[model samples]
Target: MARELTTLVTGGKFYEGPRWHDGQWWVSDFYRRSVFTVTTDGVETHQFDVDEQPSGMGWLPDGSLVVVSMKDRHLVRRAPDGTVGHYADLSSVAGGHVNDMVVDDRGRVYVGNFGFDLMGGAPMGPADLARVDPDGTITVVAEGLHFPNGSVITPDGSTLIVAETTGAGFVAFTITDDGSLVDRRVWASMGDVPDTTDVMEALGSGLPAPDGCTLDAEGHIWFADAVGARVARVAPGGEIVESVPMPDGLGAFACQLGGEDGRTLLICAAPDFFEHSRSVADEAVLLTMQVDVPHAGRP
Candidate 1:
């Protein structure tokens, strides 16, 4: 079925980590260094600010908020009274700027990083995924990942799927009781990741850099392709069942399924990822489209 895309919010600088929780759409503006929530009609309220910039976010069973402090590579926790404090430090575990994260039902967090100075033009390298326990202990769960970005834990809490952006696939890991990731394997194969040095040449190859994603009731994942300017709904076997392209010149960086029945695909769109351009310009916008399947997984 054809879906209609609408702009739900605008005037942000590089939005990421769109999540549906407690009856609202929460997201982080990377360059703006703030996290906020928006309503279906476009009303928005500021949540909190992160000095090092904010990315992924989730809540604990006790109703506290956990947000990723990207530059500093730390998890900041927000209490019920709105006091924000350091939850866990990743500087020792993360080798570069931390990107996205997913928290399980038990408040265990899985984090990803750039592995190299991406914006500084350093050559891409392998990164490791870290697990942060609720009690603030950190462990490297998986390694040799090629730019692991958005991730999601299965509804049953037995498996974790991470988007390997530069690897052109999604990798799955078995989660154990001790919060360790094992049995690593490729869950989906999209295409070959470009090996060219030119950024545009790599992106123009049509091979997608899969970013933030959300799982649906049918166990299908809808993920944003950073370079393709589109969001694709892919089955477990890597078949793209649906692809929704953004308008001309705009790129989709992340997405989430939420709103009422959990069928709304909230997309984060922007023109570029360069820090200077995005931080100085208000080009980021939150768009929404209605899908057929409702969301059915952990945040």
Candidate 2:
């Protein structure tokens, strides 16, 4: 099947998270320090200066906007009254920055941090993942993960599947009653990575790094590649069933399946390597295409 790219909100800043909310798509442009809303027609990008690099996004039961402040190492909640409050100070647990997150229906946010700084071009990450409680308490849910990036929960909320970005794979954990991970194991491994990047030029090697991911109603896991420029759909058995080719042939960062019917696939891409330029999406847009299934685990 073929998919078409539609530009929704271009030429403002670096856009990352694209989430469907309140009848429109809300996204964060990290470099520009703004949050925006784009109509489904891919036109009219409105900016909200957030004063921080907001990456991932989610909503609370009370309809507050939960944004990840990467530079400040904090999770911020934007209340309906227009006040932004600190939900969690992740600096004590986050080694680098708070990148992306997945919030369950119960309002629990699971966030990931950069284990090591890669902007200097090095394979130094094995970032850890942490859970932020509703009461704003933070705890390390799992450790020794190689750059846990985008994540999703099962339809029943029984398991949390996470993408190991720098590690080139994914893992799953049984969520206990208390919100801790149990029975941790690799959900998927892309393959072994070799040293070749600029970081490898310094530290001597590179990693494949699967970045962001989502799931389908049938339990298929879909992931975006950092350098691969492809989105892969994997079956529950940990086998890749189909691969969606990205046209740009560059770093495709993240993706989510959304639409009125939940069949339109949305892609968030950086025109080039993000670490080097630290730029935003001028055409960082919302690309759409109809699919055969609806998104699973909170799109």
Candidate 3:
């Protein structure tokens, strides 16, 4: 079914890590080096600045905010009183720039990285997924993942599904009682992905490069097809049940389902993912569309 998307806001420099929290839509603007919260009617307010560039975000049980500082490979915590401080540093374990993350109900944070110097044109390689306990202890839970970008924990908090951008599918891991990941398996296989390190070649292999995503109540995942210029809803067996195309010349990069009823699908889009171009232009935007199934599970 075709759904119309409304432009919620504009003039961003590559928005990522979109989330719905505390009755507002929060997102990180890469080149802008700041995080902003937007109202349903498109009013934007700068929440905080991350000098190293911010990516993912989540909240603790006490209402404190944890944000991923990309370049420095650190997690910054913002207390309810507005004081910001370092929560944990992953530089010692992260192979590259740490990116998106998901903080579970227990305040355990699971984050991923680039695994290589992506912007520097280095060869693509596997990276590890790190888990940060509530006490701020970091551990490499899983290793050798193909660029884990966005992730989601099941409503029961028993499973974690992560988007493997270059792997062309979603990988699932059983979350143990102590916040460990086990029973690794493929949740969705998009296509026969080529075993190549070239980003363009991997993207052009006719497989969906799933980026940031959110899970719906019906057990379907809505992910941004990074190079496909659309957001696609995938079933467990790798079936694309629905897809929403982006506006002309733009590509959807990340998405989240939120709003009063959790039916609102917020999308982050830009002309391309090139850092050079996006860092210099304000072509990024936030788009919204209403869907039938409401969101379920963690961010």
TM for every model, in the order presented, reads 0.97, 0.90, 0.99
Model 1 misses residue 256 by how many Å? 0.4
Once fitted onto the true fold, the runs of candidate 2 whose alpha carbons sit more than 4 angstroms away are 45-47, 194-208, 275-283
Candidate 3: worst-modelled 10 consecutive residues by lDDT? 197-206
Q: After superposition, how far is residue 61 of candidate 1 from its true place, in Å?
A: 1.3
Error of 3 at 21 (Å): 0.9
Off by over 4 Å in 1: 195-204
Q: Candidate 2, residues 208-235: lDDT per residue as tens digits?
A: 4566677899888777777666677877
Please write out the lDDT profile of model 1 over residues 107-143, one tens digit for every residue.
Answer: 8989999887878877677899998888888999999
User: Model 3: runs farther than 4 Å from truth?
Assistant: none
Model 3, span 1-299: residue lDDT tens? 98999999999999999999989999999999998999999999998999999999999989999999999999999999999999999998898899999999999999999898888988888999999999878999999998999999999999999999999999999999999999999999999889888877888888899999999999999999998999999999799999899999999999999999999999999999999999999999999999999999998
- Model 2, residue pairs in steric clash: 11-282, 13-280, 14-280, 14-281, 121-199, 122-199, 165-209, 195-205, 195-206, 200-205
Model number with the top TM-score: 3
Error of 2 at 289 (Å): 2.0
Candidate 1: lDDT over CA atoms? 0.89
- Rate residue 107 of model 2 by lDDT: 84
lDDT for predicted candidate 2 compared with the true structure: 0.74
